[model samples]
Target: MEIIGFIAATLTTAAFLPQVYKTWKTKDVSALSLPMLLMFFVGVFIWLIYGYYKNSPSMIVANAITLCSAFLLIYFKIKYAKTP
Candidate 1:
C-alpha cells in the first residue's frame, strides 16, 4: 500500500513539473486563472495538513511539491499580468 502511495505521489507530482517549466520559460500566464490557482493552493495546503496529521509520507511529499508548483503558477500569473 505504501509503495502504491509513493507511486501515485510521484506520478501526480511529476505532472506539475511540465507546467511549471513551461510557464517559467514562456512567462505566459494569460491562460491561467487566478481563482483556480488560489483554490488549488488552498486545497493542497489542507491536504498537506491532513497528510501531516495522518503521517502519510506520500501525501506529505506530494502535496508539498504540488503546493510549491501551484504557488509558483500563482506567482507567475500575478507577475506576468498585463497592466491596462
Candidate 2:
C-alpha cells in the first residue's frame, strides 16, 4: 500500500513538470488562471504540513516538490502577465 502511494505520488508529481517547463520556455501565461494556481499552491502547502505531521515520506516529498512547481507557475504567471 505504501509502495502504491509512493508510485501514485511520483506519477502525479512528475506530471506537473511539463507544464512548468512549457511556461518557462514560452512565458505564455495567457491561459493560466491566477486563481487556480493560487488555490493549488495553498492546497499543496496544506498537504505539505499534513505530511509533516503524519510523517509520510511520500506525501512530504511529493507535496514539497509540487509546492515548488506550483509556486514557479504562479510566479511566472504574474511575472509574465500582460499589461492592460
Candidate 3:
C-alpha cells in the first residue's frame, strides 16, 4: 500500500516537471495565472507540513518536489515580467 502511495505520488508530482521545463526553456509566462501559481505554492506548502505531521514519506517527497517547481514558476513569473 505504501509502495502504491509512493508510485502514485511520483507520477503525479513528476507530471509538473514538463511545464517547469517548458517554462524554463521558453521563459514564457504570458499564459500562466499568477494567482493560480500562488495558490498552488501555498497549498503544496501546507501539504508538506501535513505530511510531516502524518509521517508520510510519499506526501513529503511529492510535496517537496512539487514545491520546487511551484517556486520556480513563481520565480520565473517575477523574473520574466521585467523582460521586454
Total backbone collisions for each predicted model: 0, 0, 0
Q: lDDT by residue for model 2 over 1-84, one digit each (tens)?
A: 678769989999999999999999999999999999999999999999998999788999999999999999999999999997
Evaluated against the true structure, the overall lDDT of model 3 is 0.92
Which run of 10 residues does model 1 get worst, by summed lDDT?
Answer: 75-84
lDDT tens per residue, model 3, 1-84: 679879989899889999999998999899888899999999999999999999899999999999999999999998887545
- Two-way TM-score contest, 1 vs 2, winner: 1
In model 1, pairs of residues that clash are: none
Off by over 4 Å in 2: none
Q: What C-alpha lDDT values do all the predictions have?
A: 0.95, 0.94, 0.92
Would you list the rank order by TM-score, best first?
1, 2, 3
Give the lowest summed-lDDT range of ten residues in model 3.
75-84
Q: Is candidate 1 or candidate 3 better by lDDT?
A: 1
Per-residue C-alpha lDDT of model 1 across residues 1-84, encoded as one tens digit per residue: 788889999999999999999999999899899999999999999999999999899999999999999999999999999975
* Prediction 2 global C-alpha lDDT: 0.94
Cα RMSD of all models vs. native, in order, equals: 0.9, 1.1, 1.6
Residue 6's C-alpha lDDT in candidate 3? Answer: 96
- What TM-score does each of the candidates earn? 0.94, 0.92, 0.92
TM-score of 3: 0.92
The global Cα lDDT (0 to 1) of model 1 is 0.95
